[model samples]
Target chain A: MEFLNQNSLYIVLIITVICWFGIFGYLLSLDKKIKKLEEKINKE
Target chain B: MVFKIILGIGLTLVIIAGIALPMVSNPSSFFELPVVPGLEDKARIIFFHVPTAWVCVIAFITSLIYGIQYLRTKEILYDIKSVTAAGLGFLFCILATVTGAIWSKFTWGAFWNWDPRQTSIFVLLLIYGAYFALRSSIEVEEKRASLSAVYSIIAGLTVPFFIFIIPRIVSSLHPDPIINPQGKIHMNPTMLVIFLSSLTGFTAVYYWMFNLRVRFSKLLYQQQMKEQE
Candidate 1:
């Protein structure tokens, strides 16, 4: 516990959060583009 | 929502079953550490890097499969699926590269060493990237699909050589001979669990993303057609 606290726990946490977020954002945006296309297809 | 909940439960079970078991054992737990020689510790990344890389391989092969399917049937659906596979494959390739880079950086010092493994994966990325570029370069539908199909097929042959063969040839500073030549990777029960669980989790993510991408790409193509009309 002491070692975990004195060390870079926060740094690791931040990096992980950022990495997952980047992945989430990327996939979400791609899904949005697909949704937009679906609407266009429906209109046609 | 229901399926997501089921997936969540399944993933939770996998983590608990595989990761938690190995971590709790003392003698076997150290198997997780980097002190082991022959880079056994780095083999931990096998769960992430190898699976993701293989998933990327699957993605590309999928693209090639559909590309050929398009060639035979000339169905627009097959073409859309092919491009979707390429896009998702490219994403996994990026993930594999990033994970491998970080693993190499920690084990071998520099973040981006020009080692045989690193160089080959980078080249693979370039080849796949060009597949997209070639598709875009041609405006006509059939022409674009056929051209990209040829490229996808050629590019895929390099994947096996890059991911497997070349890394073994030179005296690599990287870990060696665990995954290959069966009976080499003798993992303790605990480490095996975490390793296997991670592989399963990553594989699940790969399939979900692949499905989503194919659905989305179909929409994109239809949108393009709608606009043209």
Candidate 2:
């Protein structure tokens, strides 16, 4: 807590990193869903 | 599979290094970034912001290529690819503009001052906005594809002029571009490495997104055809 208070930019960086990971994870899931849909359509 | 893993890990490392690296006036070691006189810690925006613009340019050029290919081959797949690329370009263009605006607020003391660089990108946004508008207004598939292809080619021709030439012609508050008139990078070696790495990582991310979009678009087109049949 003390270190974070002293170095506030790191806090922003941490938040940004978390947000990026969240977005990346969302994209990964979306890609998997698209792939599954493609397979289903092909099978039909 | 390997490329995806590499891209994920590589971008994570880039973000860490770009944000966490210490900036010093005199960078005596490899890890320390030389402080750009006016930018200071704010200089870090280069890693993320510039890449968005670079990706935007790359996406636009790709759209242009596929547009030309569509015109030559008259294939629906090429049209799909062309439009997908343009959509991605527009998205990144917006990212670039927003990121630039935020950075400008800190550096230039305003969100927008109508700097030459800002003006040019605004014009580009309008041009591509019209491209999408033209695309959606046409109901006929073939007509929409060919007309948009021609429009994309013309819009792409203007890209180089707007992104590269106009900014240089008029003096502005914006910093000299990475590839300046002197044709030399002014960054310290450590900064350059991270900057180049960030560029590569962002480009890979763009490619991944482009692939996913094109695949999804193709699937949608197939479904539409089946429904019509």
Candidate 3:
């Protein structure tokens, strides 16, 4: 707990990076899903 | 596919650099000007907070344009686009509000201030939320599309008033950074670079999210059409 308080800035930096990377990851996965959907729809 | 991948990689890099640069850079006391007095280093929140609010307004404007297009053409696709844009707009609006609330809690020593800017943004959130509720409550597809498009148009028109005009018209603790006549940013050069980079990075993120949502909806529509066949 004391470690968290003293290093709040680094903690924030880590959290921010994680959150942003998570968003990008979600978008990347969604892009893949859309590609597959497009392929499926095109086949019909 | 390649374009989007490249864009994704580029945007991720820019956003990471934006966030990292601000955190790592030294705070300057040049000209005895501080971005936000009393907040000091914590004023770095400005990079994230301001850009999210800007993106929110951009999303609302995009929604408004699509709403108008839907009304003009009465095309279902236009309506779909409008609703999708509104959905993203509302999410970013809520983001802005939440980030602002957190900043306020730390800076002002309270979470909810009822300041003019705070009140206006809260109202904007409620308005956007109501737009979603209104859409979900309607059962008929055509009616939902048409009515919600009209509602979105009206609500979207009011966003500028809520976000920009009203807050400035009344006193508020939130800094009126853009409205300065000179249009000059007052900050250390490094801070300015990070601020501008964050703004660009956020805009990129907004478009990327918007495109993802729109394409996902298009896929769903395709699925729906096949089901009706």
Candidate 4:
């Protein structure tokens, strides 16, 4: 807690990075799902 | 495959360098960022915030290009591309707005100051919001495509005016843009490199998302056609 109080910018950086990872993970999953759907449609 | 790997690594590096780098009054080395007088630590927001706005503009311009193609070709695929691009633009625009608003609360003492830049982006959100509303209202395929294409072209034309022109013509509390009236970037070379890298990385991510969206839309269109048969 004392360390974070002294280095608040790192907190912001950590939050920003977590948000970016969340968005990136969502995109990757969406990409995988789309690929699966494309395969299913092609096989139909 | 190689492109995605490089992009992932490059973007990760950009985020780390943009945020974690030390800011100093005098940057004697490559690793340190020169602190802007009015914005010290907060200046770091530029690497993240500006890229969202930049991606919004790129997505809007892409939407405009696809809109023109749809009008010229009268193709449903082009229409799909245009709308997907516009949707992505809207998403990025909202991201920019939210990020800017958060930064504003800390810097400007208020969340909503109605500054020229803020006002202009607000108006832009409305304009693009109406585009989606117009799209949803029309059920007919051909008519919807033609009308929305024309609307997107007009909306895109206004983007530069709102984002670039209006913010410059009027004085506001906003900091000088990277490309200011003096036409000089007053940034440390290290900071400039990181900024540009962030812009390139975000634009690449936008391209990836746009491809995924367009492909999904195309697949949905095909499924609908099959159902209609």
Best by the DockQ measure: 4
Candidate 3 chain B, run of 10 with poorest lDDT: B24-33
**Candidate achieving higher DockQ, 2 or 4:** 4
lDDT of 2 by residue, B1-229 (tens): 6787787788888888889989887889999887777778888888899899999999999999999999999999999999999999999999999999999999999999999999999999999999999999999999999999999999999999998899989987777647564532268888788889889988988898999999999999998998999
Model 3: residue A43 alpha-carbon error in angstroms:
0.8
Q: lDDT tens digits, residues B1-229, model 1?
A: 4554454555555433432222222364444422234454455455557777878888888888888898889798988788888888899899889988998887788889898888888998999999888988999888888888778778877778887888778655555435554434455655566566656666676777887867866666666776899
Candidate 3 displacement at residue B125 in angstroms: 1.2
Q: Which RMSD values do the candidates have, in order?
A: 4.3, 2.0, 3.6, 1.7
lDDT of 3 by residue, B30-92 (tens): 212243455655666777888889999998999999999998998888888888788888888
Docking class of 3: medium
lDDT of each: 0.70, 0.89, 0.78, 0.90
- For chain B alone, what TM-score does every candidate structure achieve against the true structure? 0.81, 0.96, 0.85, 0.97
Clashing pairs in 4: none
Q: Which ten residues in a row have the lowest lDDT in candidate 2 chain B?
A: B177-186
Report chain A TM-scores, every model: 0.68, 0.85, 0.87, 0.86
Q: What does the lDDT read for residue B196 in candidate 1?
A: 67
Candidate 3 regions with alpha-carbon error over 4 angstroms: A1-3, B1-36, B180-185
Clashing pairs in 1: B22-B190
Clashes of each: 1, 0, 0, 0
Query: Backbone clash tally for model 2?
Result: 0
> Rank order by lDDT, top first?
4, 2, 3, 1
Q: What residue runs in model 2 are displaced by over 4 Å at the alpha carbon?
A: A1-5, B181-185
As for candidate 4, its interface RMSD to one decimal place is: 0.9
